[model samples]
Each structure stands twice: as C-alpha cells, then as structure tokens.
Target: MIPSVILLEKGASTIHADVGEILFHEDSMALFYYQVLNGRVRLSNFLSDGREVLHNVICANEGFGEVAILDNGLNTVTAIADSSCTLLKISSKKFFEIMHEYGHLHHVISQKIARELHFKLFMIKLIYNRSPEEILSNLIHKLNESKRLVCQECNRLMLTRQQLANMTGLRVETIIRTMKQMEKDDKLNIVRGKVFVPADGID
Candidate 1:
C-alpha cells in the first residue's frame, strides 16, 4: 500500500475543496506541497491550441505539486480537484524540515515522482495510436499497473466512457463502440454501467 501523509503532515494544514476547484495554476509560485487525504486531483497542462492534456490523476494518500518546490521554480502544471477533496498543504520550507527528520519520507516521495514520470511517458506513446481497441486495452492495463484502479469484480473501473475518452483523446462515441467490441471479445465486461476487466484479466 502507498504511504499516507503522516510524517510529512507535521506542519501541514488540512483544506477541503469541492470538485473542479483549482489548487494551483501553472506558472504560479509553488509555495506548498500537497497530499490528497481523500478524493482525486488532476494535474494537467493546457496547450496553445486550447487542448488540455492530463498529466496525472493523483488519488487518496498520494502527494503532488512538489516539483516546483524542489527546483525553486514556478509550477509546471495546474492541479484541480477531480472530486470533492481533503488535502494537506505544507509550506515548501517546512516540508523539507520534516523530510530531514523522517528520512524515509524522501524515499516515498522519490518513488511516487518516478512512477508519475513513467506513467506520463507511457501515455505519450499510447496517445498517438490510431487503433481504438488497442488504445483502450492498453489504457486499461496501464491503469491497473499504476494502481489508479483495481481489476477485481468487486472493484471494477469507476471511470465513465467519457472519462476514458478524455484520457485517450478519443470521442465518447468511439469509446462506447470500442467498449462494445471489447465486451463481445471477452476482453471486458460491463455490469450495472460499470466496466470490468475479464476474470482472467487483460492479457
């Protein structure tokens, strides 16, 4: 299980935000490091053409918005609450102070940052693909590996077809059609409007 904010919560302040609330904007000063105590946070960047590319979806017990602090530079991406969220906010200076006391906190942060980098790089390659079925399958597998969602019957994917479309840059119509095809192929199953990978899992 991923570590929650305990050691790092030393001088942190808890804040509640509603869905779609912006925690910080790109190019803004990164004064704080944030951890999600509940709900999800989306890290994304807007293109010059007005397209938004989602970089990461950080869930409960995950920490984010630390890159700018480490570099002493502006934020590279905007953070928005994907759902009504509980967040722990700690000043950059104080965050370091706590890290010094709890050395293992540094390891946890490093591992998470590395995983985020790997996920984004994988998505960059997956996003340019033209095959709908292949893209969707790869995306499902990736999400499972990233621990963003589990694949068991009791814990099926919570993402809607539209949400899958946004992640893959596909249209919702395409997502629905592709899902139907995948379902018919026994690659996935949909019950009560929730999507699930097959019992044998994605192979």
Candidate 2:
C-alpha cells in the first residue's frame, strides 16, 4: 500500500488554503511538512527577472517539506496551492520520531532526496544543452520513474506537442516547429492529438 501523510500520527495541524495561496515561503525555515489531502500544490522557482519557472506540481496524497525536515535548513523552493487545498501537517519533531520508528519511512525519504537530485540535473541540461525533444523525453522518463506517478492504468498513450513543451521549459512555437520537422523526416507520426514513435506500432 502507498503510505500517505494523512495516516501519520502527527498531531492536529490541518490547514486550508485558497487558490494561489502560498503554503510555504521560499527559504523560510520549516517547522513541519504537510500532506496534501486535497487540491494541488505548485513548486515554483521565482526568477530575478520576474518569471515564474514552474518546477513541479504536487497533487492530493503527496507530502511536502522533506527538504527542510531532513536538513534543518530553509525551504529551497516556494510551495503554493493552485486550487483550494486541504493539508494534514506533521511537526518536524514528530516526523523524526516516525522515521526512527519506521524503517520504510527512512527509505522513502532517501528516495525522495535522490529523485530530486536527478531532476535537478535534468533541469540544468534543459536550460543549458538539450533540444526541446530531448528535454521533453527526459522529462517524461523522469516523471515515469518518480514514485509519485503511477501509470499502470493507461497504455499506448501519447502526448501533444504543446503538452510536451510545457515540461521541457520551451516555448510552444519552438515545439511546434520541431515536431513539424520530425514529422516530415518520419521520426514520429503525428495524428489526432497523439504523437507516436512510428507510423504503426505498439507503445
């Protein structure tokens, strides 16, 4: 079974947030991490140029604040709700207690850290080196590998060009032009909102 923050014996610390509400400020010290029971959480990087670079989205049944919880440092990124949100919070003290009591919790925490490290490397590549197609492909593979995403329900599915671009941090226009070129070369088959690897093959 997937472990959830709602099940944690962390005390009475539930909170509600409206859309666009900041749950945790960037670089702020964390007293507790939260388990999202409902709604969406966006983890974003605010640039000096005033651009909001979206990093990742955390939906219901997810936990946040692990970075500070593990290292006793300020929040690395800001967390805000994208919609009405219900969160179950656990104090840092209680979090450590649970970790001490549960070996699996320790494993989960370690994996979270490792995954974030891998993600950061890809983000660096996306910003510095790779093309949109390469970046988008890496992004999808990263999502698929993350413990947070489950994909068993659907098979042989595909993504739209714009949809792929969002994850790659590239402009929609660039993605369109790149895809058009790929389509011409028969590197991909674009049909009815799905971009397939071949003209006819199983996903």
Question: By TM-score, who's the top model here?
Answer: 1
- Superposed Cα deviation of residue 66, candidate 1 (Å): 1.3
Query: Residue by residue across 126-152, what tens digits does model 2's lDDT show?
Result: 666457656544555455455333233
Candidate 1 RMSD to the real structure: 2.3
> Model 2 TM-score?
0.72
TM-score against native, each model = 0.88, 0.72
Highest lDDT: give the candidate number.
1
What is the clash count of model 1?
A: 0
Q: Among all windows of ten consecutive residues in candidate 2, which has the lowest summed lDDT?
A: 148-157
Per-model CA lDDT versus the true structure: 0.80, 0.67
Q: Could you tell me the lDDT of residue 142 within candidate 1?
A: 76
lDDT value, candidate 1, whole model: 0.80
